[model samples]
Target: MASMFRAASVAFFCILSIAVADAQPIKPSASTQGFHSRARLIGGGQQGEHWLAGIEITLDQGFKTYWRTPGDSGLPPRFDWSGSENVASTEIRWPAPKRHEDAAGVAYVYGKQAVIPVLVKPKDPTKPIRLVLALEYGVCKDICIPANADLTLDLSGADSERKAIEAALAKVPLLQKLGAQADLSILSIAPVAGDKPAFTVTIQAPPGTKPALFPEGPENWFFSASHPAEGDRFTVTIEEKPKDVSGPVPLHLTLVAGDKAVETEVSLDENGKPR
Candidate 1:
């Protein structure tokens, strides 16, 4: 009986070691001559309702990553979280993007190392959460490289790493403010020609202010190359819907003046125009 008990203890120890090793944090890696990416869970215990996760992308010395709008030359980042359990929803808050122009054209994006913050809410407060993200993005140098990565993060309610997560969450407020203070009165949206359903938006930026407009919803309804025209006013052609699209479509705009950012929401008019 004594020998049997000792053997059982040894086996348990080995299993515990394997489990701990499997839970180690993931490191960034590169597949091609492009960008390297890493993801990790940050805060878990401070707030019982939500946790923070950070995804960082380090572009190779000369390569660049695409923005939410990848312009005409790159592919936008794609994320999938079908395997996540105990997660109510994941919210990705992006930092303000900059405008980059080369021989191809002017593109808006974040270069170098960009830290994207994600908020994860768990359905059960007592259970541990597993988040699996399948991400695909394009990195451009002289040529563009399409890359994919699988990122996993285990969230524990009692983890000590929560402190770092909370710090990252602090930077998100600036981005949130950028999405909340756009000057909507400068934009005039109206139905356009063609029966296929479309609209034209003329944006008037304040003198010396170059603003870019980003639509918050109905992702399929707008054109991909809606660049904000510079000068006293700008105009962008957007594809409208035959009728109001299902669900709620909140027209959130992001206005950037140099390094300053502001956001505003535009409500739909009675005629389906962006008011």
Candidate 2:
């Protein structure tokens, strides 16, 4: 009886230790090339209000990452946090990306490192928040190499984490200003007769500025075969399908003024109507 009691005590203690270790939060590891990825929660998690979060990627020397729309080739990084508790919703707020063209193809990417801001809302602040980011991005040199990571972050009463997130969020506005701030006025959107329906987007930009417009949505709905006619006014021919006609589509316009770049989002009217 004495031996059995001792054995039971030992077993219980071992189980308790394992449980404690399992409950401890896990920190994400940076890439071997010194590419670190992290996420943190900022302010405003009270009651019904949403909080701000940041997902940051710090790249090493000679490494590059893709943008939301990676142009002809290259896959954009993806995030998956379906099992998070106390996280009502999460969204990625991307800065304007630059255009890159090489022998491989045309692509959009963020050189060096980038901090992607996100909005997070919690249904109940009392519960602990666990966010998992499963990211897959392509890094290019002469050829493209695919990289993936499963990054996990804790977002419950972490003041230090909040501060770091806020710092990252602070940079977003400045980055936007540096990238694309071209004020584009949509003059018209008209339909054309073809095997696939099409629409022409006529825009007016600031004098001495050449802006490139990229559709933010899926490629099947919005094709990029159109050419840009330069003048005081610029025109881009876009394919208009049933999928593209559901609602307004936002275009990320990047204007290059000398060596500087500015990005702006313009919404198009439905049914190819002038806006």
Candidate 3:
């Protein structure tokens, strides 16, 4: 799971693109080749059973970086931690990304500075762990510039990164159980009634929800432009059916509404309604 998380790209972007406990200021080394980036370990993360950590990317004024799924163009970030000690696995996660539209297309990105959170597990619960990270990412403006960062940290004592780490972690979208509801809800899904087997999802949200959604689907398939159809109603188009698949094609969505975000997964039948 950690390996996959480290490799998984979304825009919470380890492809998309910090913290401590009560907090000693653990300033990690900067990557000489890329944007200013370092590793951080949060003390007693969330439930207190595992350590929370991530990579921090600091972009200068007017510069931007891509998300895990960089909408149209841009490179995703990657993490390699084989140099660390006392490590078991790591789950790299992303905070919701802002939508950036350019002549290149629509790409998800972080404006100014970005702090990406990672969930870390140790090989020994009783011993300390040193996390070494080799990260690669891209920053853009008129043209895209590729960057790399190598950072390391030993988490044993001192926990001063809590505030920053928690702040970043809090931005991550909360995952709801299957078929559960939250501040957001999916109102409808239906087939496009064409040979493409495409579908449309209608979302019902509060007034001025300004919801921005991210799609998780199968390969060779993607989501089209999402726009407001009517008041508080928006539609997202899925391009095609799941290829080489069976039972049901499950689609996942992450909706970001200002400070609130929720993630949900649904399996739809041929008609596009959640089954």
The digit string of per-residue lDDT tens for model 2 on 1-275 reads: 99999999999999999999999865553222323322222332322365555666666566667877777677787877675667878877666566677787667777766667777777776677666666667776656677766565665444444555554554332224212324544444455555553545555556675545554443454445334554533344454435446546655554433234445455555543323
Model 1 RMSD in Å is 9.3
lDDT of 3 by residue, 9-85 (tens): 54245322212332554344533435433223344343365687757777778888877877667887888989888
lDDT of each: 0.59, 0.57, 0.68
Q: List the residue pairs that clash in candidate 2.
A: 179-261, 179-262, 179-263, 180-262, 180-263, 181-262, 181-263
Candidate 2 to truth, TM: 0.61
TM-scores across all candidates?
0.61, 0.61, 0.76
Q: Which candidate is the best by TM-score?
A: 3
Clashes of each: 7, 7, 18
The candidate maximizing lDDT is 3
In model 2, where do residues sit more than 4 Å from their true spots?
1-48, 156-182, 191-199, 216-219, 225-228, 231-275
Q: CA lDDT of 68 in candidate 3?
A: 80
lDDT of 3 at 54: 56
Query: In model 1, where do residues sit more than 4 Å from their true spots?
Result: 1-48, 157-211, 214-232, 238-252, 265-275
- Please give the range of 10 consecutive residues that has the lowest summed lDDT in model 3: 13-22
